[model samples]
Target: MDTSLLFWNNIISTCGVPRIITSDRDPKFTSELWTNLYDMLGTKIPFSMAYHPQKDGLSERMIQTMGISLGDHLNKNLLSIHPTAKDVHDMWKKACEKDAKCIAEAKEYNKQRWDKSHKEPDSKEGDQVLVSILNFNNLKGPKKMRDSFLGHFTIIKLIGKNEVEVRLTKDFSRKHPVFPVILIKPYFQTEEYRFPSSKKNPTAPEIVEVEDSPGPVKRIIKASKIRLNGKDQRQYLVRFKNQTADKDKLLAEDAIPDANLHLRRFRASRRTE
Candidate 1:
């Protein structure tokens, strides 16, 4: 029989055709024949994300358990094991219930261990925080024995559960914007520990005018034409190459020379209509 025909025949004859099917994005599952057959049957198929086995963790775990059980049975040389479908189903259900209880107990124990000293941080959005360095094993010099936790970063947003998006304070860093709650601590400002002016956020008006400010003298990005005001007058946009440069500038073609000398010639040559 044809593969498509056999596949549908097995599904309809065995399980009476399921309404929803969850499977990995295997070639067979994504085949035109498989897709067309399911479409005609009005079945919904949800595929696991590519390269992420955790999405099909339940199936993977079951396969692992089956392998273990087969190994144990083979080692023991068990035979004459004949059981009805109902008997096997009952046994599996009982085992699943017992496993669920064990999992619940294990989770409770793990929660207690984590919560013993780890209080829920009262830090809110915009609160300054000290983020713990994940892998800091390079400390050797006497001066290098500084605080393990860097930052005083402002919390930009709270991610799902125990994660926050933070922007580094003081000097800038190219680290990840988001960090787990366990790796963060609320930063309290005191007389001994005043907030550094270098890290302080500028006024809203200044922030709004961020695009107008030119970044470091050394850094300059490619120029793009913004608009054409007159027949010969063109406005070009300048973007700072620096990672810290979030805002870009829109300047007249003539003013490019005064803004940055490096871009003056480049803008003159690469002017688009």
Candidate 2:
């Protein structure tokens, strides 16, 4: 905390206190001390939403530009210090040659290590594959005990040579549809029984088909105010009848016409609280 305050104090001394700050939900930034300090300074701190960093895109791009500019400036300074242009050119050429050699050696080493444990995946567009669950935390139960892979989902298309895009369901909306070849494996169907059963089932349940409307709204779980197109709008986290909590969807207020009564009740309850 002291270190963070000292760093920010130095920045403030140099650039003056900023009117607004945008940051990710890092522990240091979210601490009560940090919040109180900013509150006292009358600076608004708008945190980027979880899993969304594009909110700070401008700052990130600026930092990247500064890094590139600084590197080029340093190189120019080094060239100026050298006795001759030829000497600088030769030094650059040698550096490039060494870099290329190191890169080639690294690639060969990685390839050999990969070959020891993995065969080159033969997946192609339209093939069904199971994706590794290693990167996702949405699954229920202990991580070690849970299934290591999910889906026989179809591949939508090849994304470059190393990654393939899969057609994922709504449950996986938070995750990118593209997965690396290393994290996916070919899915094969189980063989049918060779021997037939002697006895047949006495009863079979009749199947009923129901027309889909927006399924009945179970309840409005929560609400949040968001800015869209330079305007503020309220979005509700809604759970529909027969749907699990994990399947809850975020909908704009206007989209849930059928849930108006529930929305009203929710607002009334919030007011009381």
Q: Rate the local accuracy (lDDT) of all candidates.
A: 0.68, 0.80
**Model 2: per-residue Cα lDDT over 117-151, one tens digit each:** 97767788899899999788778887778888999
Regions of candidate 2 where Cα sits further than 4 Å from its true position: 1-119, 191-273
Q: Residues 1-273, candidate 1: write the lDDT tens digits.
A: 266678778867787776555677889778887778777777767677535666676775676689998887553323345435437668999999999999999999999998997777676799989988664444455645677787778998999878999886534455568888988887877734665554655566644444344654332355444434555544555665463545666566555545557666565656752
TM-scores, all models, native as reference: 0.33, 0.31
| Cand. 2 TM to true fold | 0.31
Q: Ten residues in a row with the worst lDDT in model 1? A: 75-84
Residue pairs in steric clash, candidate 1? none
Where in model 1 is the C-alpha error above 4 Å?
1-103, 135-144, 191-273
